[model samples]
Target: MDLNLIALIMGIVEGLTEYLPISSTGHLILVGSWLGFTGETAKIFEVFIQLGSILAIAVLYRHRFYSFLTLAQFQKKGLNLLHIFLGILPAAVLGFVFYDWIKTLFSPYVVVFALLAGAILMIAAQLAKRKVTAESLDQLTYRQAFLIGLFQTLALWPGFSRAGATISGGLLLGASYKTAAEFSFLVAVPIMFGTTGFDLIKNLDVLHPQDFGVFAIGFVTAFVVAMLAVVTFLKVLNRLKLIPFAIYRILLAGVLFYYLYF
Candidate 1:
């Protein structure tokens, strides 16, 4: 297959899945498995393009991050960024330790299982109507942020779906759906950025000159599409429920099983 074509497909997958509870990693696994196996180049591409999505997240939430960087100007904004960083810490530690083992899960069958399991959890959360939000309005305590980071680590599994894990973990920990989703997105910035950065640094040897064109195209494509997705998701999420995505996951799982088995 053409490298540009693969980049385009994966870029669309990233843009669409980065926000939704449907695993971006899972889709990338399936797509790459079908098109190109996860070798050095593919792994590099997969990881770096995620940075593009992370860039999108930062842009969409620019105000929050800016206030965080320029903390002296806005005390409240600084605290918000503080909590977000605190929320990211646990996952960063886990990811650094288990990086190689975690990378091996990007396969079609694994992704299928992840999509199915994650969807089921989403369904259950919707059914229960439970709610939990951080008790402190000032800033999330270290404990709360740490717990969310621990939950974020579960997303290391390709099918496990970071959105699914974080959101479900939040619910399990007594968080409201809205809070869970919001926090999940907030914490994702670091994880995605780290993944992209680490992969690029490690795979610099295999990245040929020609690869840059496709990678750049894919990164920009992912950024544009993902920014639009982020805006659209925040808008619709409040008014809508996640059941539709659950059904979509189940259907996707069925398709993956069929493809893998037969």
Candidate 2:
């Protein structure tokens, strides 16, 4: 297949999955594996292309961010900042500490197992009975914010979706479904940017000139698709539950395992 075609497919997949409770990294790794596109450069390309989805979130939530910056809302702003900070801290610390080890587990076998485990957890979260108290992001307490962030650390394993972990965690912590999804998206902005930015700086020299076009195509495609996905997902959030996504994950894992490992 043409490199450009590969980029297009990947970009579409990334955009569609990045914000969903389905793992974007898991899909990327699995898709790349099947496409025979795995290697150091491919890994770097994946990291760099996530910027597209990050941009979508930034654009979609720009108004909320502007509110956070208002002078009169300084106290609320401070609390918001603290919430975001605490939410991302556990992942930052754990990812930095296990960077190399985490990379090693990016293989198909690990992804398959992680997918199954995460799917089970997602289903369990849906089934668990918990009173919903946090109806909005502003209503989230610091402890709940911190715990949600802690749940995000589970996403270091590729098949464990970041959105899934945080959203499920939010549900377990008494947040409404909409509030959980919104917080998951908000926290993703910083986490994706921070990790992708670091990787880009560290690997900039290794990127090839020929690959720049592919990267651009993937990035643009991801951004456009992600924008559409974000809007659609939000609309359906209240009507749908995580069980469907969890089931999809399990089915995907089963198929991939048989095809790749059998």
Candidate 3:
């Protein structure tokens, strides 16, 4: 396949899956493997394109973020920058510590099991009866945010999914689906920016001048597709919820398992 085509395909995959309970990294690894686009360059490309999806979230939630600039908004009783920091803290620490080790796990085999495990977790969280303490993002507590952060560490393993882990954690901690999803999207911005930026800088020597065109194509495509995806997902989240996504993951896992091992 042409490099530009690969970039386009990867951009679509990243944008579609980045914010979903299905893992974007997992999908990228699997797709890249099928396309024979493996190696360090592929890894860097995958990470770099994710910034586009994160940008979409930042844009979609611009007003909410804009509110952070005001002292009065900070003084009000609700979700704030502190909550976002707490949500990001655990994964950020662990990811930085185990960055190299984690990279080695970016295989389709790991993704298959991860997809299955994450699906089970989502299903369990959905079935488990829990009190809804935080129906809105505003009602979320510091402890709950921290616990969600802990769950996010699970995503250090590709295919586990940052959204799946954090959202399930929120569900288990008594937050409603909308609140969990919103919070999950919100916290993704800074964490992804930090991680992707770090990866880009660390791999700057690997980048060729020819790679810029491919990277730019993927980046722009992800941003545009992600904007549409996020909006559509939010509109239907309450009605369809996590179960549907879990089922999709399970089915995908089974297909990949058969393809890989059979």
**Could you estimate the TM-score for every candidate?**
0.87, 0.95, 0.96
Candidate 2 residue spans exceeding 4 A from truth:
76-79
Worst 10 residues of 2 by lDDT: 70-79
Clashing pairs in 1: 132-174, 132-175, 132-176
Clashing pairs in 2: none
Global lDDT scores for all candidate models = 0.76, 0.89, 0.91
For candidate 1, write residues 69-148 as lDDT tens digits: 76474443323656777778878887889889877776777888788888887778677755455533233455666677
Best by lDDT: 3
Tens digits of per-residue lDDT, candidate 2, 85-192, equal 899999999988998798788777788888888898889899999999888888898999999999999999988899999999999999999899999998999999
Stretches of candidate 3 off by over 4 Å are none
Report the C-alpha displacement of residue 154, candidate 2, in angstroms: 0.4
Looking at model 2, residue 10 earns an lDDT score of 93
For model 3, how does the per-residue alpha-carbon lDDT over 1-262 read when each residue is reduced to its tens digit?
9999999999999999999999887788778878999988988899889999999998999999988777876778998888988999999999999999998897888999999999999999999999999999999999999999999899888889999999999999999999999999998898899989998999999899989999999999999999998888888989998999999999888878887997
